[model samples]
Target: EPEVTQTPSHQVTQMGQEVILRCVPISNHLYFYWYRQILGQKVEFLVSFYNNEISEKSEIFDDQFSVERPDGSNFTLKIRSTKLEDSAMYFCASRTGLNTEAFFGQGTRLTVV
Candidate 1:
C-alpha cells in the first residue's frame, strides 16, 4: 500500500537552530496534516492543508512553524527556530477525503537541546 514517507527519521539540533521536517504524503490524497507527540503525550494536531492553502491550524502552530507542499509530491514542516520544548515526534498524515481513514508516516523524532 502507498504510505506517507518522512526523511531523517531522527534529528538533533541546538535550541536556536532551524529545522525542516520533510514528508511525501500518499500521492492521491487531497488533504494533509502535521501532528506532533511530545515524549509521552497524546498526539496533537498542528495544522491542515488543502487546495494548496492552509485550511486550519491549532494554537500550538505559531509563527515559528510553517507547512508547505512546495511541489506536487512533497510536503514539509519548518520550524524557524528550535526550542527545547519543541522536542517531539513529528508525524505527517493524509486522507483521501472527509470521513476516510488518515494514513500517518513513521514520524521524525526531533531532539532539541
Candidate 2:
C-alpha cells in the first residue's frame, strides 16, 4: 500500500532559525494535514489542506508556520523561526476522503535549542 513519506527522520536546529520539513503524501489522497506531538503529548492538529487551499487550521498554526503543495505530490510545512517549544515529531497525514482512514508519515523529529 502507498504511504506518506517524510524526509530527514531527525533534524536539529537552533532557535530563531528556519526549517522546512518535507513530505510526499499518497498520490491519490485528497486531503492533507500536518500534526505534531510534543514528546509525550497527544498529537495536535496544525492545519488541513484541500484543493490547494487551507480548509482549516488550529490556533497552533500561527503565522510562523506555513504549508504548501509546491507540486502535485509534495506537501511541505515550513517553520519560519524555530522555538525550543517547537521540538517534537511532526507528522504528515493524508486521506482519500473525510471518513477514510488517514495514512501518516514516519514523522520528522525536530529538536530546537
Candidate 3:
C-alpha cells in the first residue's frame, strides 16, 4: 500500500529562523493538505492545495507560510520566520478525490527555542 512520507521527522530551530518541512504523498493522490498540532492542542488544518494552486487555507497560514509542489512529487511547507507558537507537529495529507479518505504522514515535530 502507499503512504505519505515526511523527512527530518524531528527538527530544532531558533525562534527567528526559517524552516522547510518536506513530504511526498501517494503518487495518485490529488488533493494535498498541511495540518499541525501544537503540543497539548488539537490538530488544526493549515492549508490545502490542488491543481498547483491553494484551494483553502486557515488563518494560521498567513504571510509567513507557503507551500509548493516543486517537482510534482515533493510537497514542501516553508515558514519564513519561526516563532515559539510555531512549534508543532506538522502533518502532510493527501486524498484521491474530494470524498475519499485522506492519508496522513508521520508528523514532523518542530521545536523552536
TM per prediction: 0.98, 0.98, 0.98
Query: What is the full ranking by lDDT, best candidate first?
Result: 3, 2, 1
Q: What's the lDDT for candidate 1?
A: 0.96
lDDT by residue for model 3 over 83-106, one digit each (tens)? 999999999999999999999999
Model 1 lDDT per residue over 17-104, tens place: 9999999999999999999999999999999999999999999999999999988889999999999999999999999998999999
Best by lDDT: 3
> How would you encode candidate 2's per-residue C-alpha lDDT over 53-77 as one tens digit per residue?
9999999999999999988999999
User: Model 2 reaches what TM-score against the true structure?
Assistant: 0.98
Assess the local accuracy of residue 66 in candidate 1 as a C-alpha lDDT between 0 and 100. 95
- What are the clashing pairs of model 2? none
State the displacement of the C-alpha of residue 47, model 2, in Å, after optimal TM-score superposition. 0.3
Please report, in order, the local distance difference test score of every candidate based on alpha carbons.
Answer: 0.96, 0.97, 0.98
